[model samples]
Target: MQIKRKLTEREQKLLQILINERNKGIQEIAQLAKTDIHDLKTIIDSAIDELDLSFLNQNKEIDCTLISAYNEKLKNIEHAIDRLAEGNYGSCQKCGQPIPEKRLEALPFALYCVNCQKKKEEKNKEATQRSYPMREEI
Candidate 1:
């Protein structure tokens, strides 16, 4: 069996950053959960006063969106941690090249390097345009 290698300083730093980000996300979600419970109580009390329910519904929708966004960020951070454990955290998944240190520092959860990411975005944009063509003015 091969011996495991130690992580470099940069890798350790990246791992710390990912862990910090994950913790922050969890704390934010927990805070949001508490706020949601309070909001629900407020909504019930306000409904008894014949207040507008639509405003409460809008608030609920916004809370849901925030929760979803936080959950997605947490998932990405978890994936990055897993990749770091697998010894491929700083490599581009699409092109199989080492991702730039600056890019990784900016977005530790990035899967594709800059070029591959740009290409993927362009392709997605093209597909979106095709799916919803603009109408010509009459």
Candidate 2:
């Protein structure tokens, strides 16, 4: 059990504040964030619309499914935050190595280190390839 370095006190406080604020109902959260509720509503609405377009390509029939998918992604982000609090953040889930600080700074919810993430993506690409192998000429 490796004890990863804990986030700084300031960072931890900031993260906790942000998480608590973000989870509140949009109207209340927007008030707490010092922004207009209409603007926040617009942002969330646009995000859901963009997700729907990307997932269903303008098909209305799948809108609910797309919304569920997007909500699931948000849940995963929350889970990553829980992992961070448990002193397991910034370490690759697959290889158990420390992830680069830069990566963690850029993406607070990342689960795998860069190398492992890249290799996993490459493996997926190879496994999902649709082309046939070429034959050698005699």
Candidate 3:
């Protein structure tokens, strides 16, 4: 039988540092990593580049928008953390089903299972479309 590797203390420390220094400059994380500046810059730069590609498409003006989005995402994560502290993190918010441990491990901020999340997203999309329906010539 294969056992899953629980996140180690060192790994947890690294993750904590990374999360806390997310808004700080690369030099700070480099110092924490105990690595050379160039190597630290490369790691931070690559992560930022990947994030830009995914969220901002490298547009400088969209930085504020990305920040807002990130803020909202963080709020959700905070709510999840609150649930975790309350001993309710793994249950689906909508259906009360137990969220899989694998899913929770992959995304500690997740508040819903796949089905509940999809349903909520679909409902939100429908509401958005209804609120701003496109006009078509008949």
Best by TM-score: 1
Most accurate candidate by lDDT: 1
lDDT tens string, model 1, 72-100?
A: 77767766777787687888888899887
- What ranges in model 2 sit over 4 Å off? 1-70, 129-131, 135-138
Global CA lDDT computed for model 2:
0.57
- Residue-level lDDT tens digits of model 3 in 82-106: 4444455567878998766666656
Tens-digit lDDT string for candidate 2 (67-93): 445455545545556666676556789
What total of clashing residue pairs does each candidate reach?
Answer: 0, 0, 0
Better of 1 and 2 by TM-score: 1
How close is each model in CA RMSD to the real structure? 10.9, 9.6, 11.4
Off by over 4 Å in 3: 1-85
**What would the TM-scores of all predictions be?**
0.58, 0.45, 0.42
**Per-candidate local distance difference test:** 0.69, 0.57, 0.53
lDDT head-to-head 2 vs 3, winner:
2
